[model samples]
Target: MTFQSVFRWFGRRGQSTVHQVDQDGQKEFTFRAVALGLIIGCLLCFTNLYFGLQTGWISMMSLQSALIGYLMSKFLPTPITAQENIVLQTTAVATGTMPLAAGFVGILPALGLLEEDRDGTPPVHLSWIASVGWSCAVAFFGVFLSPPIRKQVIIEEQLAFPSGTATAQLISVLHELPPPDTTLRQRRGYTELDTEETLNDELSPVEPTELERLHEAAKPEPEGWSSLTWSFLASGIMTLGAYFFPVIFSVPLFGNYLAKQWLWTFTPSLSYIGQGIIMGFPTTLSMNLGMLVGWGILSPISKHAGWAPGPVGDMTSGARGWILWTSLAIMCSDSLVSLGPVISEIVYKKLLRRSISLEDEEDKEDKEVEPDDRLVPMKWVIWGLSGSVVFGTILVWMVFGNEGIKPWATLVGFVMGGLLSVLGVRALGETDLNPVSGLGKISQLLFAWIQPGNVVANIIAGGVAEAGAQQAGDLMQDLKTGHLIRASPRAQFYGQLIGSFLSIIVTTTAYTLYNRAYQIPGPSFPAPTAYVWLGLARLLRDGDLPEKSNVFMLAFGLFFGLVSAIKTYASQRQRWYAKWIPSGVAFAIGFLNTPSFSIARLIGGVVEYIYYRQVGKENGGIRLIIIASGFVLGEGVVSVISLILRTFGVGVASCWGCAHGMCGGCPS
Candidate 1:
């Protein structure tokens, strides 16, 4: 069947709904609308990249893009005048590209030891061709892998697709706004909603049931606009200020102190939760507590000091530590966790819930599924996994373990890393396994066994660790969006592929330039902690746990799991407590990472909460959300660009004169 016919079969391709009528009183999904959204998405992506390079907040891309997209729709005339179309496409691009970009730029160059041909050039480190080629290959694999996982996480587990939901919410609201009415009524002024209905009536078929459903669906839901607006703006101001004036403007208290005291901190402090919230005492306390757990309690005290907890460490060490290790564990564990839920959904629904769908289907046989169809066959998942492994192998081959490291050697590393990851996942399943500790142990072993310059070996090991952890967290979230929207696995896969491939190219070029301009540290920056892990492993081989090592992670994990179970149970009995508990946990996690991060989370949360409490409107809430999106995209791109610069010896911090300028004013 033709693409148009296929879409029509899905009930998605039809005349524009009454809520989507424009000034011309026309109604139908048009190419113009889709094109408009694509254009906005592209522009927002570029703007985000520009700002990310200029500043250091990597996560600002989503917020920035959303804000910009909303503003554009509000002010400019587009083929698709609805808010939902604009925001959804824009955020899809921004959110999907971030990690792919960051990982490509940071990991590829570091692994390849790619250096520029400058005066007294650092002996031809990594080849550009190899790095880029490897990136494309990896992109292809990630594109394929990310989608299936996303579906499993989203469709099966039914977790919140927070970011996607935020974007979709914005777009849906905008789509529903009544179009401007032109024809004057005989009795009075022109009517607004009637104009929209009149336009919609001409284009749509006479399906009474569908029309009723559409009308009911079009009704606006209550939203928290004012609170969201203030919080978004406040968070943006705090983040921007911290990025520009980190040292001088210290994020009020703890984040600054942590950055100052620590040798490496991931993500800056201004990006944390408690940055500038004088009124958010509960939020502040939660975040600070989280910081104490993540950094002081976890990073320093746990066995995984090999990888610093936050963004900076990930950047500094090429993520030789926990960042990678934990990510891999998360991925595998989540996949395992999601399996049960997904099977249940398919079986129970297929066997039982068929009557509801079957009766509907009887009226319409040969119906087509949309590209956004969330349900996926198991076959595609198997293909995705095979493809992921193949691409992962290729990634290790060309870019990372490039310095004459044997393929066999790298495979060994992968095996070791994978085994450790599995162990960590298993432990975390039943009990909390302080994943970093497991990562530290494995990294320590490799450090002792694999010499420096064995880039391929290290890269493979690193990939296993990182992917594992990231997959664990990401699988559920992506899957949640898939379940809600029913986005096709292929579409999701390709979307990620497009994102990853493009990001890799962007990352490589930007980082190369940044590294060249700055007289920063060489390709051989210290992996002090990584080596420390190596030493520890040797001691373990000789038989002895470090005197200061804490093995209480399992206990902690169990305790937290119990707490989570209790909260989940309580939430069923008292919905208010459920929301509050989750909010509190979120706040704590934010604080644990960086004060700035915590601050941003709190702002987003409060904005959402307050909007729900007052005015019962959605437009303002969506607009504010878009504003947050703008900031997120803007900062994320800038940071990605900055990383590229650093890779080339052009110190982004130095080039920008951050030591004395706004960037240097960080409290820590």
Candidate 2:
């Protein structure tokens, strides 16, 4: 079937129901919406877990869920309003985050890997009931934390929760506003959203304005929708082509020999390009720069100098092993340092009973707060947070108390999770990325000090932070959607709670079933991030690290911290100069992944720059963001397709052919 036919099929199904509005008027929350949200959310939850195990990444699914909700709304018994649509997508997003939040794809699996000598045996220490209850309680507390910070970030600070904003726009355009072909927008005098000046980190400074402004921003012309449709289809096709015909991704630089050794393949993955667009120029450039410095320069030198004992591509004793410490150092230090002040400020204001907004804002709207009736009351937060913290701590202590995690330590973790959640929200607001894993790692580091070499304590502590940060970030993003649509915070919060509750039972069952079917860390299902978690645990337990690396790691960490500090300072004092500084976290990510991936990200960054220069969005042209969204969705589609294909034994999914020279076992 052609792409046009596919678009037409969706278009035919995506229309709003004429009977949607009754005389009493449609409600913002409904049984039909919640039911669909649960159904869709459960599917996405399983897929996310599967994807995370394979690729060490999990994507937020609000946009995709929203898209699906749009197409499926026609089948619902009662039609959903745009506000109700937020509830549906919010539920789906919350459910989908559970694998990572509950540690099925990270800490819990890592514990098993640590015990089974990487052979994928289940952890004897784990109890199914305890884990489920604890995970539920932990994720439960995260929902409460979002309400306290909603006004500060969304209203006064005006942080751009990009994915939330994008999803909000999508819902408004699809359900709330008139169709793009109509004259209603002109009649209402709704103007297009003007994107503000981007921060150094690519955060667009947009206010949480009225519902109409969001509609204007998201509503695309007919041609724009066509562009979005085509970009999405093309990206999916390209992903498939790259997989089947490796030649598409095997473009070489500086001849086959050097290119192969240097990992210089120009794999033009549209997914990476879409990421680059969302991640922005500075961050993507830093990733490429790190790839060059780490792989292009350091790897060759380390091998010849006998600093690394394994083969070039070997992860354990090669450049990958030694360099990761430095990467971890830079990432950890920068994340903490960059986020500390904001957390401190939030705390400082809370203590003083002072308003949290910065002193520079002039707009009356900036000081406005959502009515108390629409907001989540403090009583709910108190009962919810305390109840869950106490519940989660008891269960966690019961499960791992024998392993040296005292109940006090568990409480500390829950408390720390509440604090670190701010980091996740701030990062998501700015970058459309939540550094949950990073937050988790930091928690692990703290527990290393608190409990001192108890790997169980470290993992559980990390899990709490991971769960809290992810769920908190997810809620805030949904609330951003609610903010745009005039949905009640209390209603959305309850919808989020329903999803979180569902996730515990659904995700745990999915993981258990998948484990019985295959070796988790084995070839078919390499829970890659689990290995990172395992490594940290080993380092804590046995200090099993390579020699001659501490000095390098320390030096790099200090350098990264210094530069990050400068960047933070510059962002406030020297705005122009801040753009010139590389993001330490992004740059350090080079050591975390393959060389070719960074190069792909660089291609994306360059494409975005070129797009702005040439097309210019001159006088409200086709939406570039729609194309970016398409690329992301298309990539997700291919990932699911790829997973299914692999399940049926499509191919080994290996790269036998390098950009320069094909290996002897390659197809050619």
Clashes found in each candidate (C-alpha, N, C closer than 3 A): 119, 1
Residue-level lDDT of model 2, residues 94-138, one tens digit each, is 888888888887777777754545322336435667667667758
Off by over 4 Å in 1: 1-77, 81-91, 94-130, 145-166, 177-246, 249-286, 293-368, 371-392, 401-496, 513-546, 552-554, 567-575, 582-619, 633-668
Across 148-231, the per-residue lDDT of candidate 1 in tens digits comes to 444332322223333433333333333443321112212111111121111011111122223333334323222233333445
Q: How many backbone clashes does candidate 1 have?
A: 119
Clashes of 2: 1
Highest TM-score scorer:
2
Instruction: Give the alpha-carbon lDDT of every model.
Output: 0.37, 0.66
Model 2 stretches with alpha carbons more than 4 Å out: 1-26, 31-81, 115-137, 151-266, 343-373, 377-379, 394-401, 404-408, 422-438, 502-531, 540-544, 617-622, 648-668
- Estimate the TM-score of every prediction: 0.53, 0.76
Report the C-alpha displacement of residue 155, candidate 2, in angstroms. 6.2
Instruction: Check candidate 2 and list the clashing pairs.
Output: 256-660
